[model samples]
Target: MRILVVEDQDSIRRMIEALVQARGYEVTAVSSGAKALDVILTAPHDLVLLDLMLPGQYDGFEVCRRLRADPSTRAIPVFIISAMDDPESRRKATEAGANAFYTKPFSPIALLKEIERLTTGKG
Candidate 1:
């Protein structure tokens, strides 16, 4: 499956990319939500792992909203990855149309499991 990871932190982004690549999935990693949008618009991705704190006009929430608003991408699965560990943050992510919410310091295996479930129609 093809996945897109939008994370600003270089180390974290590379870590996620390595983990996902190890899972035998093709991944496209970008540092900002805007770049993510550009790629999403140009090609198809099975799923998206988005960071809430982004370095652009659109945060992950806004990016998720925009994706959901677009007809072509509205059905794509999105998982919000953030360090904002609060009930409100989770609620906002769901409201913004994220399929799942994962906080920072997350388990790479668990995250991959969730991604598999979402993409495979098991979650």
Candidate 2:
């Protein structure tokens, strides 16, 4: 499975990349939402692990919305992982058509398991 991880934090991005790589999945990690959109537009990813807050004008929410709006990419699975652990954040995720929402300080194994379920149809 190919997973695209969008995280602004270097450490966190590298950590998630390593974790996903260990799971035997192809990973393409990007530091900003703009870069994510660029890659996402160019090719299809099996799953997208997106962070809510980003450094660009288009944050994860916007990215998610665009993905959902585009007929070609509307059905792609999006998982929102963010430090903004608020009701509003979760609401925004749902509005943007995210398949799952995860807060920061999340369990690595749990994330992996959920990714497995989404991509492979089994956890």
Candidate 3:
């Protein structure tokens, strides 16, 4: 399945891309939420792994909101993968319509399993 990873940090983004790719998934990663939006709206993706804080006009939350707002992309699964591991952040992510939440330094296994479950209805 196709996975779009949106993370501003270069090292983090690379790590995530590598891990996800290693699991035999097609991954498209971007350094900003703007690029992410552009990519998503233009093409189809099975899942999105987004970081909360971004460096452009749009943050991950806004991206998720936009994706959820548009009927065409509304059903695409979005998972917030951020460093903000607080209750409020989690709540905001939920309110923004994320399918799942994972904090930074997340378990690769859990991510893979979630992707499996979300994309194929099996894990």
lDDT of each: 0.95, 0.92, 0.91
lDDT for model 2 comes to: 0.92
Predictions: Cα RMSD each: 0.8, 0.9, 1.1
lDDT of 1 by residue, 1-123 (tens): 999999999999999999999999999999998999999999899999999999979899999999999999999999999999899889999999999998989998899999999999885
Residue pairs in collision within model 1: none
Which lDDT tens digits does candidate 2 get at residues 1-123? 799999999999999999999989999999898999899889889999999899978899999999899898887899999999999889989998999988989999999988988887884
Error of 1 at 29 (Å): 0.4
Which should have the higher TM-score, number 1 or number 3? 1
Candidate 3 lDDT over residue span 54-90, tens digit each: 9979998999999999998899999888889999999
* Residue 100 C-alpha lDDT in model 3: 90
Those runs of model 1 whose alpha carbons end farther than 4 Å from true positions after fitting are: none
Residue 57, model 3: lDDT of: 97
Show the lowest summed lDDT stretch of 10 residues, model 3.
114-123
Error of 3 at 35 (Å): 0.7
